[model samples]
Target: MNQSVFQKAMNEIHSRRLHASAENERRFQEINTVIPELAEINFQMAQTASRILHGEKIDKIRQQNLQAQRYARQLLVTHGYPEDYLDMHYTCPYCQDTGYFQGRYCTCLEKEIASLSVETLNRNTQLQLRSFDQFSLEYYRGLTKSNTKGETVDCYAKMKKTLDYCIQYARNFTAHAPSLLLYGEVGVGKTHLSLSIVTEVLRQGYEVIYDSVGNLTSQIEQEHFNREKSDINTLKLLLDAELLVMDDLGTEFQTSFTDSVIYNLINTRLNRNLPTIISTNLTPGKLEEQYDERIMSRLCAVYQVWELMGEDIRMLKMKERRSSQYL
Candidate 1:
C-alpha cells in the first residue's frame, strides 16, 4: 500500500505536463486570427524551447517576450503575486513537461513508471504479513533444566531450535532450497511459523500463495470436475507463485479425486523445481496409514520433515487471557 502511494505520485508528473501543453495550445489558438504575428512568435518560441529541451542544439532568434514572461514569473513575489504561482506552472523546463526528449520518453519518467509497475504488482498482495519479530517464544511449552556439557534437550528447547531454523530458512530462502514438512501437534506454532516464512519471503519480493488443504481440495475439485474442465486462474497462481504454502495437509476430505489432485500438485511443483511447504498434525506413522505409502514416500523423499513437539499454545493463550480478565 505504501509503495503504491509513491508510484502514483510519480505518475502524476507526466499527467501535469500533458495538461499544461493542452492548455497552452488552446490559448494560442484563440489569438491566432486576431494577432497573427504575436501568436505566431509565441507558438514558434514554445516550439524552439521544446526542441532545446529534447537535446536538439538549434540556434533561433531569442523571444524577448518569452524572457519577459520568465522574468515576470521569477519576480512574482516582488510584483505582489503568489510565490508558488510560477512553480505551480513548472512544466518540465527540460521537456516542456511533455515528457519526451528527441521523440522518446524521458529517462526520469520511464524509470519512475517502471518502479511504479513493480510496486503496483507488489501491492496486489496483502502487505501486513506476519514476521519473525512478532513471533512468540512463549508458544513453546515448559522444559526441564538442561544438564551442562551437551545434555539432552526438552520439548521447549527443541521447539525453540525449530523456530530459529524457520527464521533462518525464511531469511535465506531460494527457489532451490529444500521443501519443508512441518508435522506436529495442533496449536504448537506450526501455522505461526509458516506465516512468518510467508511474510519474510514477501519482503524479499517473492510471490506466495497460502491455502489450507481443505480449501484447496474443494477448489480443485470444483474447478476440475464439478464446474469447468479447466480453471486458468487456479493454474496461473499455482504455477507462478514463488512459494506455495499447503497448510494442514492431511486433514482434507478423502476422495480418489482429491488424493490424485493433491499428489499431482506436489508432484508437478517438485518436477518444475518449485518449492512447497506443507504443515500437518499427522505423525509419520499416521501419514503412511492414512495416505498410501506411495504418496507419503514421495513427500518424504522431496521434503525435510521437522516433527514439532510442544503442548497446545492456543490453550495456554486462552488461559492467560482469562487470568488477565479476572484481574
Candidate 2:
C-alpha cells in the first residue's frame, strides 16, 4: 500500500475524531441548558472517578453515576430527543473514529486505506488540476466542417460536441461503464477531457488509475527487467484499476516489450469488462502503424471512440502570455 494512502486514512480519522468531539460538545451544550444540575452531576462523576486512583471502592460512585445517566436519559426522552442523543456520537462507532481498536487498525480504517492505496497506485497527481468546469470550448472557435477523412476538423461546434460527450461520460460513469478512446492532435484537449473525466469519476467515489503512456511504459519496463523478483509490479495496478485513464498514448518510446505490455493491459482490461480511457495524439491509421492490429482492434472496436477537434490551445495560451508581456 502507498504511504500516502495510509496518511490519507489517518487524516480521515482525525477529521472524524474532531467531528465526534464537536457533536458531543454540541449535545452537551443543548442538554446542559435544559438541565443545569446535569453539569454538576457530570463534575461530581469526574471527581468520583478520581477516587479510584486513591484505592477507593467504586460501588457507591457507580450507583450515583448510573442514577445520573438514567436522569439524563429521562430528561432527553421528555424533551423529544433520543436516549443516547447526548452521548458522544461517532461516524464509525466501532473504533470511535480513532482508526484503531484493540491495538490494531480497525476494519473501517483498513478499508479506507485499501481504497486509497488502489487509487494512489494508479493515479498521477500532476493531472489533478484539469476539470470539466475549467475547460474552455471557446478556444475551439472556427468552421464546423468535417475533413475528407470523415473526421470532424478544427471547429468550435465539433469540439463542443466532444466536450458534451466527455461531460456526460464523466457524470454517468460507473464500475461497468464503457471504455473510452480520446484521439486528437497535440494540445487539442484530449488529455484535458480525459483528466476531467477521471476527476469526476474519482469524485463519484470510484478508484481510478491515471498515467501518461510515457511514464507508464517506463515504470513497467523498469519492473520487467528488475533482477529482484520481489519488487511490486505496477502492471497489475494498471490492469486492475476500476477506471484506467492512459494519457498521451503514442508518446512512449515504443519497443517490443512496451508493445506487448500495452496490448496485455488494454486487452486484459477489455476481457474483464473493466473501463479504460485512452488519450492519444494518433489517428486510427497512425495508431495501427505504431501498435499492432490486436491493440488497435481492441481500442477502436471495444472503446467508445471520441475524436476531439480544435486549435492548439497551448499555442494560444503561449501567444496570449507573450502579448501580455508586450502590454
Candidate 2 differs from the real structure by a C-alpha RMSD in angstroms, to one decimal, of: 6.0
Steric clash count of candidate 1: 1
Q: What do the candidate models score in CA lDDT, each in turn?
A: 0.69, 0.80
The C-alpha TM-scores of every prediction are: 0.58, 0.65
By TM-score, how accurate is candidate 2?
Answer: 0.65
**TM-score quality measure for candidate 1:** 0.58
Tens-place lDDT digits, model 1, residues 99-127:
56788866655545544543443344343
The collision pairs in model 2 are none
lDDT of 2 at 26: 84
